[model samples]
Target chain A: MADDIAGRGDPIKTLQLMWGRIEAPKRGPKSKLAVADLVRAAVRLADEEGIDAVSTRRVAEAVGISPMSFYTHIPDKAVLLDLMLDAVARPADGSEEAQAFRPEDWRANVAFVAREYRAFYLRHPWVLQVATHRPVLGPNTMRAYDYFLAAFDGLNLSEVEMDLSVTMVANYVHGAVRDVARARMVKELTGMSDDEWWHAIAPFLETVDFSPYPVASRIGPVVGELYGLGDPDRAFEFGLECLLDGLAVMVERKGGRR
Target chain B: MADDIAGRGDPIKTLQLMWGRIEAPKRGPKSKLAVADLVRAAVRLADEEGIDAVSTRRVAEAVGISPMSFYTHIPDKAVLLDLMLDAVARPADGSEEAQAFRPEDWRANVAFVAREYRAFYLRHPWVLQVATHRPVLGPNTMRAYDYFLAAFDGLNLSEVEMDLSVTMVANYVHGAVRDVARARMVKELTGMSDDEWWHAIAPFLETVDFSPYPVASRIGPVVGELYGLGDPDRAFEFGLECLLDGLAVMVERKGGRR
Candidate 1:
């Protein structure tokens, strides 16, 4: 356990050895494998086959290395998943938008961040599941959170209130994405298109007496029709707008505190 | 199937016969195996062994019937799941509160419904996963939805706004309960007492620099502390208050648009 430094055969210093491998300079004039390279490969695998398919052996093979070789950089599969999440969550520069932030432009800023975050999740649905659980304190996640906090800085909210607001938004985004992703997975696995399945289940909807739930029942059809627009981005945006609208009212009532 | 129904069965009706057997009544003089019975059994199985342990066969056996017998009332495992969901989602009696509704009473009413709904989910965590996937049109589900929608009926929100508001509240309840359930499962499977695990993870949390994500980082400890409170009632109340506080502003702004 004492001789493997970046695959040189050290055991006792496993974590340190892995960190060294991750930080090692590129060996070739062009490129050799790096932690980032491995993370990218893992993300690609997850995108194609779902997160359940990802493993040290699978990622190593994708990177043209032996499974044991992966130990040089990542301590375990959990660490690899963390790194992959971080790689995908790299802070959105949205510099153009960030620079545009102004006291009067708070709503726009909120909308922009929400849209960008939704886009990020849309591009990597697996991230939603992973990030919601076992949230790794990674650089990318921090960056994303930083942008959100900064957006609300001018609202003069109490620490607790601010925390609650951020939690609400984050959970909303996470939950919405999870819903959209599951819907997509169901579509892929069942081979029954969303509308086709809805039609099959329509009889159930039609026979149910919703007088007891007039609001939901009345709007059920419209919501059902919007089910899998085959695009999460739009659904997310719609939900976000409504959430922000609700938040906007809160902001005003709190005397513009933030 | 005809023999069971008419004393002579047709070959083409074998499949139907099998389904009828699956749906046959359970034991006891009062027992008339219905979809409700299977759903109740399925819920019990889920609560005892987790959702993965629930299947048509398991449910049938639990009710003292052949595996094939479950098909009669439920048609398929998916429908069994749907039935279980509806059974668990039976409406909360908000009539007492609804009769006393006032502008200021809205928050408490919403909180009550949310708490009841959360309690329902926590009692049967498996329902959280299913509830998040699709729209609910079952009688029980509708009754629950109507209770929520009725809370805000006189508050002056537009039809669309009212729908969106309900969705947001439902999303929050579902997400929070799901998180708690997952945490509970982890604690059970890992065999680590919550305190022991938290102490072990504390050092890592302290060593991690979360300055970049001031809000999430600062609030991480609070979130972690609240992690396994497992009382869906408490979490639901907390989130519901925040949401209602947010919605109160919306109500004020709309100037009683109803």
Candidate 2:
């Protein structure tokens, strides 16, 4: 899961697969499945099951190939993971997400980029589980980074601030997606909505004294009644606005924009 | 590891346990271990290993008891997990973290609360792996939430906004912690500092063309040089300031705080 650090594999071999510079297969009766086919199957398996299910052997089985032959196609799970990460980095061509590079209206462009990541992550939720902090050095990953930075091209900030700005947006989005995803997973796993689950525990909770925690006691129920732990969109939008406002304030301080 | 949802176990029994109201054990020769002892063992195991290693049998083995006998101490892994969560929730008494009930400077209080969560999560990083969206209906968890809400007692937000304000801070902290923690884990697992690892891979990355990603091509290396994946504190602080700034703007808009 989170332990699966990207760029941990043999850099040359993994980079070869990521950049589509893979050498020819060993001479034998070759399998029909290409590297892309394995990655596709792995992604499907991850989306259906979870990141832990994306084992090399399991992926090979899904593609109707023997594990032995699959080894020839890809070296190991690490390389396959890098491939999966970089592959998903690209939005479908001509999609609104693919065009997230408007130099004008930098805030709107930044917001759009943030939303695109949220959408893509929710679609391939497993990607959120992988730690891409090691930096997935691939074409599409690079393209996505470049594209995201393009949104800030119109802004007057140092290159480092621009990079840090992207990190902030990415961090906020990651947290927001996790909040929503956790709620969905708990509901699915327990077959109980947060409300129903709370209802079941209310009687027991009533036996305990809540006087010691006046604020949590008062605010806890309000948060529950409001968001039901399942919906954090309101909270997310609130935070996003605050973050952007803060960024704009900084720009103004620099005598750049007001 | 992220799949372990809190409050998924039997709620009444779990809630009973969380409130320290466990029923008497079934008729048997009692083993000399309280539930606290078992939870401590489980927490230690998780810290040394990972969350997945905290199975009932494994914890039982760690605490020097048969798996069958351990069942008497706790019903199952689910209950054990809930207990471990709440047990870790409490900071050591009289520590700066344990005393996070500042109502004076709201922003500093919020920042302090954020820092405490980050510190504790780093110490017990496995907690980050467990999805606590269902909300561990335990005293310590409740106390933590309530205490956190106290930091915003001076904020002029609506009830729902108050709840969301806390959520925003929590989400930002969560994201920040994950960033720092991911860096720490990658360094430990690869046994290579990010700089060392990047130096090894730099030769191969050079072979890949970067003409398509002009912005990334410019900023990516600067980011690497500034703060390798192993270091994200500067970026985190930058984002936190922006978040607070953004929040201040909203309060001003509400005609509450200047």
Candidate 3:
């Protein structure tokens, strides 16, 4: 044991040394660890084995450390999970660098954010579970929200109205992407693609009498295609355009009110 | 055993009898059991004990029947779950009775439906899990879709556009309500109301510098309020209006195109 300790670094001694450094009466060198590294590994695990595979120990193992060692950096598994969610959702930088932007130019900005957000969700399907519900806010999460809010700064509206507008748009994108991801996952797992799944289920759709409910039958085919195509990004773009146009009306109405 | 069987009416026998009657081996009295009754019982179980508490045996016990008897009317738990989802999402019956209403009049109708849908989800939070992810095409599900699609009639958009429009609106409401319900449940279980929870975590939120990011900080307040407010119905209404306004723009644009 002494030779092992002398020849190779002592596991406990090394841990103690690291712990000493971290606890060192002063913050320096940053322990060669970061929240981003942990989040990145968690995302990788989620992508490889699905969201269910993500656990503090697994993430710690991926980072080559004891599970207990993670607690020094993060509070708990929930914190790690929340951080992972934010990391995946962090918006693309330089969105604002495109200077030709305007506040009333809701269409372009909304579409841009929607596409970016959809891409984020697609890359990390597990994030949908975290995003769709109330979340424990993390650094990355706050940043993404700030970016969205900043995009809407020039639009004429009350603080509350701006808040509501941003919420609606974000929720819409989150919902649409989630549905798309679910369909995709099902296709991947069942070997029955969206089109095949729809074909199999089409008979059931037809057998049901929808005359008393005419609209569903009228639009069922189209809704079917939208979902069946399995392109969340397209859906996000389409819906974002519709929502922004709606907001434009509000902007006009606000202008009139003022 | 005999006494227990007498008291319980032979679980398998009861189910087989109900099944045989419904199937009509020859021409027997149609099974007295109704799908509506089963769905109601299931909903009650979900509401009172949460969705996880719902099961075939529990539902059967609630209805004072054998678990096996349920299969006569519903194929399995999944079918029962689907039926419950449809029941909760039942549409307003008299929507089409107003023949004189114009396309713009459709907004109020859609809003009304949106409100009802939100209430349905609030009343049965468990339904959100199944409804959002699963592709169960039950009668009521079709009927609800038909009603929403009908609201867009005479708008002059292609079938595909109309379908996407309706989906955008429906999905927004569904996703919004799901988020609200989850927050409410978490609050209830944790014994910390939404505001209390936020205040408790405020330090964490403040320390989490998401400045370089925009979406989280900009939208955090709204998301915070959404959770803080005991009722999410108002938020749902606000979002529905935004979505409708967006669709209205599309309708106007299409008319201009024509």
Candidate 4:
């Protein structure tokens, strides 16, 4: 259920559409509308409201186009979603900026990529709901993937190790971002801040015999206080440091980083 | 929309019910159902048909009770979900089993816990959908949390570091499982294995310019081949090793483990 893109229409066709390989229909009256325009409209809707709020009718209404015209540009919600992801997947930073990093500083380059990817997911968490396994390879998505792959240059990792290493960083950042984002959503949905909610449950918690959990009992308060400070970013920062440290150790053990 | 236990009725009341601190209704015409029964039914339904399949009416029907009677035991779906998580969150391994590890073997203990937690998520993926942020602290959940916290005994980490270290492992495992699970679901949904899908796209992928992405172009084949072997678990294993390695390094840097 997590990453099923079943309704996204045909993967090949969606990829073609995403890459802008297919030209606009010549038979229809030349409309000013473009696929990018339709994708932008849908992404805006998903950003403000969740992805469920995005519909063909709703997007068409938002963009001041007829549903039929919208269909010509993108056939269904699935393809539109692929386009939305591709749109956001565009490397927000310039290629020149990426290239400016020294080739030897692979770790820094990786951290840069990780930070960017985390920010991208935070901006459009609906991206998390879509299937990342068999993603429709658009230009932006491909460029982004390529950018990440480039970060491992001369790291001395085996081919498989390279992929898996990038993936580990990605998985950690994704989990961290999702935790932060989900915690925020919980706050909104429960109509209570983390402090308010913890305060509400504190009395009940006090009754529990936490004596058995010396570590959790001692540290739980500190952890809760950190979260209560309204800065979810600290967790991410800590995680990132640990991850990079681990990566260095991995590289060293695997015959040293170039 | 990730962590919202809204309308779970009251947090304190729900906790009491979950902890079995409150007695089952003595006044319900001697119905055989207990709250645990309803929760088990819900968990079974979720396991078989996914979380969305778990509705109040459906659970009530599954338990052979009137929906009204079910409501007396659990007021709403949110609270029911809390109970469901608590039910699954129970420490499957005995603490005696957990304590069998030597105190100095914290790394092994942490790895043991990570693998177990990963297995739990794979079995009950719906557990991923619930609001983990403001978890309804039932006894089972607390036990599980405490079990995780205890893994760092004598690691010399501050309370905050211990909490974050545990969290880092949890996040990495959660993310890894989601990826593996999502990949399997995508395979089923697309009716094409990852290799078959890549083969389908390879011809088109070849048409695209690869000059700009030397690293992706070089290693993409290897990455695809690994997925082709039908072993998604490799990434998780690699990640776990790296995380533990990283944790060891972190502990050493911060005044050593044990």
Evaluate every candidate with DockQ and list the scores: 0.17, 0.59, 0.24, 0.49
lDDT of 2 by residue, A133-179 (tens): 46688888888888878777756788888888888888888888886
Across all models, the iRMS values in order are 12.1, 2.7, 14.2, 3.3
Give Cα distance to truth, residue A53, candidate 1, Å: 4.5
Worst 10 residues of 3 chain B by lDDT: B1-10
Model 3: CA > 4 A from native: A1-41, A55-80, A91-106, A131-134, A202-208, A221-235, A253-258, B1-42, B55-80, B91-104, B131-134, B203-234, B253-258
Candidate 3 per-residue lDDT, tens place, B1-258, comes to: 000000112223223322232344467667666766887898888787666567778888888789888876676564565556667665445643344435556677667666766776787776655522245455566666766677677768887777777667767877788668777666554455556645655654454445565544555566556545434566667778888777777777788221
- Which is the winner by TM-score between candidate 1 and candidate 3? 3
Model 1 chain A — which ten-residue stretch has the worst lDDT? A1-10
lDDT of candidates 1 onward, in order: 0.60, 0.75, 0.61, 0.74
* RMSD to truth, every model: 9.1, 2.7, 10.6, 3.5
Specify the highest-TM-score model's number: 2
- Model 3: what is its DockQ? 0.24
Interface RMSD of 4: 3.3
Assess the local accuracy of residue B172 in candidate 3 as a C-alpha lDDT between 0 and 100.
85
**Quick one: best DockQ, which candidate?**
2
Give one digit per residue, the lDDT tens place, for model 2 in B69-156. Answer: 7887777676777788899988666777556454545667777887887788898877777655456868888878887788777567
Q: Stretches of candidate 2 above 4 Å error?
A: A1-8, A100-102, B1-8, B98-104, B254-258
Each candidate's TM vs. the true structure? 0.69, 0.92, 0.71, 0.87
Between candidates 2 and 4, the one scoring higher on TM-score is: 2
TM-score for chain A in each prediction: 0.72, 0.88, 0.70, 0.84
Tell me the chain A TM-score of model 4: 0.84
Candidate 4 error regions (>4 Å): A1-5, A26-33, A64-76, A93-99, A131-133, A212-214, A225-231, A254-258, B1-10, B21-32, B65-75, B93-99, B131-133, B226-230, B254-258
